[model samples]
Target: MVKPKDPSENPTTTTNNNKMFIGIVWNCVPELKLLLSALLFFCSLITLFQFFPSHLSFSIQDLRQCSPFPPPSSPPPLQIQHPQLQTDNNNNNNIIQQNGVIKRNFNTYGSAAYNFILMSAYRGGLNTFAVIGLSSKPLHVFGKPTYLCEWVPDSTGNGSGSVTVSGTKILPDWGYGRVYTVVVINCTFPSPVGIDGSHGGRLVLHASTSGGGDANFNLTDTIDVLEEKNGLLNSASNELAEFNKPPKYDYLYCGSPLYGNLSPQRVREWIAYHVKMFGERSHFVIYDAGGVHSEVMEVLRPWVERGYVTVQDIREQERFDGYYHNQFLVVNDCLHRYRFMTKWMFFFDVDEFIFVPKKSTIKSVMDSLEEFTQFTIEQRTISNKLCYLDDHPGKIYRKWGIEKLVYRDMMKGIRRDRKYAIQPRNVFATGVHMSENTIGKTTHKTEGKIMYYHYHGTISERREPCRQFVNTTEMKVGGKPYVVDTTMREAAGAVKRFELRMIGSALLKTRQ
Candidate 1:
């Protein structure tokens, strides 16, 4: 009555159970499963359509953030550099390689125990050797007999079995002008030999080359692990470098007072090469020696015609005659102001260049070392006592100094006829001391390359009669040739002896 009782009733419930059971037939259960799966699939598709684009946008943004684009560097931005840290990249504080034995004013550096290593090597039948310098500068072997190493083909394999060369044997001194060859003899300590001695480790070596002036002549050294010895080839971490010279330069500025026998083509080539070494964009104030410079100018006329060189004449001004050497420095400083961000000023003479252990340069050497390195390297050449191998005209005849001493009492005596200007068959023994005005006095820079080296020839070749007795013959200073174990001691002894004579003279005068 109450019509059909509520389905919640027991009979209705039974009917519902029967319907559920019946629904199992006709593939209804399978059909429901299929429907559920379809629904899930459709939902997934919709979610993908809604979220995929958002994910794609995020991915794009992430890619833009991490791309390999160079970021904006710090303010007084770092200078772009070359691989060698050679002076070619002059504007970049990055590359300052030492090519010759010209002492530089390094107002930085300190004395640290250096680990020197000497060995020889070969690559593809190219004769090569390795010499590790513990400190900077490798131009000491000059004007003297030096102990060096010979090359052995099977050198690397015969190395006393070692992986890390950091804690290797005490480095051998292979007097200057040599690198990367086997030590002719191995010893833990330096041998007291002839005038030239290897006190500090001179890892001298010889390498086989196709010809005489191949840059393949190089040194192989290991740096302290703590000093980032991971073979960094950047300007700061520069490794092996190829010397590539461009046909021309950005600009060329000649200097003054070069009045000497500097080769025209050679000087031009050096300017072009070094300008590129310091990093491609620069001008140099070259000091040309009158007639010699005119010839060079004619050769360079083509570049000038093309406006490649902004020939700024720093000459013809009121010259500072008293301190002409300092004037060179003035020209160097002026170069910086002429161009902003110019990182270097090469204030070398026509015949001079800064040297380093192997291929290292001033910029490269300083860049890699700690800022507080407080040792000074005074490059004293044995080339000439008063003569410069790369002598320009400005270097006055040194005979006057010797004559002043000789003629002090013998000006009018018969001794005058003995020799109007006595040319000594052999110069008297003398001590070699660097001028206090030289690099050792006023600078604190990280250890640098040897200041200069006279590779073309020896100082003996360059000396004139006026230079009767210059330093020594082997031209590479700051090297083994001039690295005298007894130099400092000998200098002190000489000073003491001079003082005694002076006091005795004073006492005799007073008694009279």
Candidate 2:
């Protein structure tokens, strides 16, 4: 220190002197400390933005490019809606409320609203164009419905026109309080609407009506115009050509909707016997309203595979409130659907057996009565429970229901309902028992020509049909007079062998 020390040799002393100088400066200016801290924080923020640019910066365009959010894992349950307002004569409005929302009563109004089974175009004679369908009854209290026919264009670009037609609504007296009915619309075009066999088109139905209050709506239906290959035009010749020939089937059976628990054995016998009776030129169309279960299907599958039968599953029709399985709706639909496919159409039930007397075939019976457009067949009621006393309880009971149960109801003067056959080409509308709106004469005097044996309530019986085996001398069963009638029982053996040959022996095997 005395000789003036060099800075390098006295480093600790110099460092301490510098610290002392900084301390003195910091103490004198407090602003210098604040300024340094602010500068340090600013530099740190700049470093953060430089390292993580995407995290700090986001744009609306990026959000728009992203995928949508996923839906919920499970859907909400359905809610059944009921009408809130009551309808009456004084109150005309048919308003319904659901979940605090107001809606028009489509079901009760029955104007433009209806459930349709089928819609098809019909050639009324040679020039008349018509549209027909089976629909739910439209109550006249609301108003008369107006119909408009719109012809859709075909592949040939021939049609695409509209015309207002006169709608003919026929609610047959046989509805039995059911809702379904028949609607036929006749279209009168201003010009020639070229619809024919080769050139096919479509028909659109536009319906509307006025109800009370602000209740006004429009309904529409579209259906394909069926081709009539054998239809004769006003200027056509050569009836022997392929397009001018007759339909494939001569006789067609339109069965009412089969429902409830049906015995497989009875069904098997019915199909086989009818197939044999109707011959090769006939076909059967069966509608299942919930009856053609797996067992019944097994009985019918063979004939269906052989092209003699067609089974339509109409079980969903039960949800709607209609006549006994909607039978009237079903028959009318079948009538128009197979109208041109067969010359004669039959309406009856599964339990009823159609029988022509010996020496006369079904074809002969029909040909003899060909002059009549419609003929009512006399129905002979057979006892479902009573059987012949001579029939072996074990052997005859093992046979088909129709084979063993041969007792006929002999109640005199009882007006039993009758089933009928129609030349489908001449019938406008049909019913379950018979048709009233036909073009030609209808005869109920079909005593010997044709008749059906109605085994009443036997089709649904699951238990043994021989509830009480009565002797041939017995006059009545359950107080109703009956007599031994062996008509169907005599033919039972032939029917059994025919069934075994057609469907195999599996169906005839004795049940455990």
- Indicate which candidate wins on lDDT: 2
For candidate 2, give the lDDT of residue 487: 94
- Please estimate how well model 1 matches the true structure, expressed as its whole-model Cα lDDT: 0.31
Tens digit of per-residue lDDT, candidate 1, span 1-512: 37766666878789989887887765477888898787666555444443355557665455435544433344653685544533432333343345633433323244221113221221100111123222221222211112234321122232222121111122122222122211221212122211111111122242222222223333333222111122222233222222122314332333434544444433433343334334335455544323234555653454445343344433432232212322322232233223222322233444332334546654565454323212233333322232322244454332111111110111122211000000011111100111111111223332344333322222112233233323333333233233212222222333334424423232111100
Candidate-wise lDDT, in order: 0.31, 0.71
Candidate 1 similarity to native, TM-score: 0.26
Residue 392, model 2, lDDT: 61
TM-score of each: 0.26, 0.70
lDDT of candidate 2 at residue 68, scale 0 to 100: 41
**Model 1 bad stretches (over 4 Å):** 1-257, 265-269, 287-292, 299-310, 318-322, 325-336, 359-363, 369-450, 454-512
